[model samples]
Target chain A: MNQIAETLASEHIHRDEVGAKIGMWLFLFTELILFGGMFLAYAVYRFSYRDYFALASKELDVFIGLINTLILLTSSLTMAMSITALRRGNKKLSLIFLSSTIIFALLFLVNKYFEWSAKFNHGLFPGSNDLLSLPRGEIIYFGLYYVMTGLHAVHVIIGMIILLFMLFYIKSNKVNQDYYIMLENSGLYWHLVDIIWIFLFPLFYLIH
Target chain B: MEHKNNHIVGYGTYIFVWLTLVTLTALTVTVASFDLGGFSIVVALIIASVKALLVMLIFMHLKFDDKIFRIFVAVAFLTLMIFIVLTFSDYSFIR
Candidate 1:
């Protein structure tokens, strides 16, 4: 009876690889749509108050945004390479690449911390006197900047955590060459993070 | 549903994509510094879209993924574009 019960459970478990990926992609689509709505809101606000938005954009440090973009791009490369390493059956190399990816992610968040701190030093927080005293359009611009980038940063953190779990899975031999969809999915999510930043950086920092 | 089809991308390919992405980033930064007026935003967005495409195709392996997966991604982007277009159309007439 116990053997029969185990067989029945295994039969229904059906761990379809492509199906799992399709599900992840569908979830990612929802994420894209969520960010798309925010971007549309940004578009309307910038269109309505062009000059003020431009003025507000100037307050951002292009250098920080540039550095963060490079970091994320590098991280994305490392992430892709990690999967390649795993497929090649080089567990050590894969782990190294994954570690580098996570480090780059941390570096990005560190830069974000300093950037936000500088804004706070100048009293540019959400409800600070500096931000509140600005023109309505400028206020909206900063508001969107904080919310959008903040959300993206949250995603970076989440992606890093996922990579950490993947590392453990690799260490346990659970994500080897023959079965590595977990690692691949994590890489997919990291690339999504990179893609979003590719758009976010220019929209917020380089909108001349 | 081809779960066994795996394409191992080369290190050189990733490096090349990185180079292109870096170059595009530099271009966006340099172009933004100039006084291009309305064209600046459009140029930046176009460059961004290209960078995004490279990442999606290579890093995400969309080029090698299953056909149905690619179809789903295409549908998602199409839906997003329609939403953006509709929003702009409304704003163009209303404002």
Candidate 2:
């Protein structure tokens, strides 16, 4: 009887969809607060060395930052559209949108690469001689800049991998209208990355 | 108890929000070029908040999802704000 019961438990069993969402949101809360601590550190340091921060922030390339902002925002739109497409039973369109989202993610990373390389060429790294000789505030500014943006870029990479898996899932018909939480959760994570960049952009690159 | 919600957002709405976000990005860049004294950071942060709200509400589908989802998001932001305010007290007093 026990063996029969084990066999009866199929993968199509009733799953608590709502509970899954709640759990995702709860995990997101922890992620949000984790970044909150970094923002707090940024605030304290910026407050302490207002002049140094102004000078250091001006060295950042707003143009590249602007481009990446648009890329991420557009990716968010594409990711959202992918969800809608999948739900509408158009796997082709869903995969296309997911591909676009991943491409945008790559574009953002490429821009970041050039941005960081330029800073490296100029010796703006945290403990480099140029930065070391600068005011403590400027050093702290670059330090925070590297740490925050580095961590955010890591999130972008993770998000892209998740979307890639999502694309495979959609192609396999494993994600349908009746069971698309995987897609939805990935969308949530992507948007969170975009939102964090939305705040990070103006704070680091825009404020003159 | 498998539950699925398919909130079909109009293509037009996503395009509209996209346009608005791009416009706001332009506005923030333009505003930063001007010297707003102490109000500069405040303005930038406000615009950032608005953009974040749009992504959360529409893109993330929190607007159409369960109200509890929204409530939890609200609580998270509120908790962050409380921490901010508490830190403000420390900074204000010490500095």
Model 1 lDDT on a 0 to 1 scale = 0.92
State every prediction's TM-score relative to the real structure: 0.95, 0.94
Model 1 Cα lDDT, one tens digit per residue, B1-95:
24666688999999999999999999999999998999899999999999999999999998888788779989999999999999998889993
Error of 2 at A192 (Å): 0.1
Q: Which parts of model 2 are misplaced by more than 4 Å? A: A1-12, B1-3
Grade the docking of candidate 2.
high
**CAPRI level of candidate 1:** high
lDDT of 1 by residue, A27-137 (tens): 899999999999999999989988998888988999999999999999999999999999998999999999999999999999999999999999999999889999999
- The TM-scores, chain A only, for the candidates as listed are 0.93, 0.93
Superposed on all Cα atoms, model 1 deviates from the true structure by an RMSD in Å of 3.8
In the predicted model 1, the residue pairs found to clash are: none
lDDT per residue for candidate 2 within B1-78, as digits (tens), equals 324565689778888999999999999999999999879999999999999999998998888887888889999999
Interface RMSD, candidate 2?
1.1
What is the clash count for each candidate, in the order shown? 0, 0
